[model samples]
Target: MSDSDKAFFTRASELIELANKQNQNKEVKTGEISASFMYAVARYNAWFGSTSFETKEQMQTHKQEMMEYYVERYKEMLEANMNDYIEHFDHYRKTQK
Candidate 1:
């Protein structure tokens, strides 16, 4: 792999770690935001790493297709995380109220 690829992987791993830490905390909103941002960053990295198109138009088309696939996968993972967060928060809130 290239240095750029290694750098991107390192950054992505750090972001994933941050998201994991957030997942262990009490704040659902914070965790959701962190996870969402991580997903976006990973998707961006994948696009950067995978594209072979040289022209602007071709790059845009490739990016769009990749982004669509990313979004679909991200949505499923995000939904699961959000649901778990919501359930935990709701249970905690009930104890407080």
Candidate 2:
């Protein structure tokens, strides 16, 4: 992988590691954890996008485009991951050390 891609994956892996730690607490269901994760991503993305534009009008104009972009990217990622899991169900299901 290119250095940029490696760095991107490294950051993503760190977040996943943090989420896995949170999952170790049995009181929190996986669905709840994932929902919270998605909420944080949405919240952060909104705030991050807002910082780029100086006016509410400009942000409003681009909001739909921004939402569409994120939704499409998410759908693609989810499908890819789902396929990967389905293809490697046995390996993925096995407990990792």
Candidate 3:
């Protein structure tokens, strides 16, 4: 991975660790936690994109374009992570103990 990739993963790892901590609370369902995380991300992305544009009209005009960009990027990352987990299932399970 390039330095940028390393930095990205480092930040991602920190967020995942926070989520894992929440998972440790037996009362919390993983699906609910995942949904909340996704919602928060979507909200933040909308805010970030809004700030990038000078006007609400401009932001509204590019809303679909921005959403598509994020969705595609998320799909790519999700697929990559799913494949990685599938490939290292045993190793991850061992470490989880």
Candidate 4:
């Protein structure tokens, strides 16, 4: 991984650890959100790094385009995951009751 990727991973890891910290008043949800954001940034950075660009402007444009394409896909994935989790939660609740 590149230095930029490493930085992103570090930030993401920090968020994950922060989420687990007992001292957090807002708690796990806050950390999870931050961690997710960091993960996306890291993914974006990695994506940008994977491509070749001759100019700074070209690289910037490419990054923007990639983000535009992937952000929607990421949202869809998250929604689907949330739906599955909700379904599982409902089942688990029923079983517990």
Best by TM-score: 2
lDDT of the candidates, in the order given = 0.76, 0.93, 0.95, 0.72
How high is each candidate's TM-score? 0.42, 0.94, 0.90, 0.46
- Tens-digit lDDT track of model 4 for 1-97: 9999999889867865755563366654765666776787778676666577777778777777767767787799679878887979978668756
Off by over 4 Å in 4: 1-50, 91-97
RMSD (Å) per prediction: 8.4, 1.3, 1.3, 7.9
- Per lDDT, the best of the predicted structures is 3
lDDT of 3 by residue, 1-97 (tens): 8999999989999999999999999999999899989999999999999999899999999999999999999999999999999999999989988
Clashing pairs in 2: none
lDDT of 2 by residue, 1-97 (tens): 9999999999989989988999999999989989999999999899998998999999999999999988998999999999999998889889553
How close to the true structure is residue 17 of candidate 1, measured as C-alpha lDDT?
Answer: 82
lDDT of 3 at 49: 91
Candidate 2: 10-residue stretch with minimal lDDT: 88-97
RMSD of 2: 1.3
In angstroms, give how far residue 77 of model 1 lies from its true place.
1.5
Candidate 2 has a TM-score of 0.94
Candidate 2 segments whose C-alpha is farther than 4 A from its true place: none
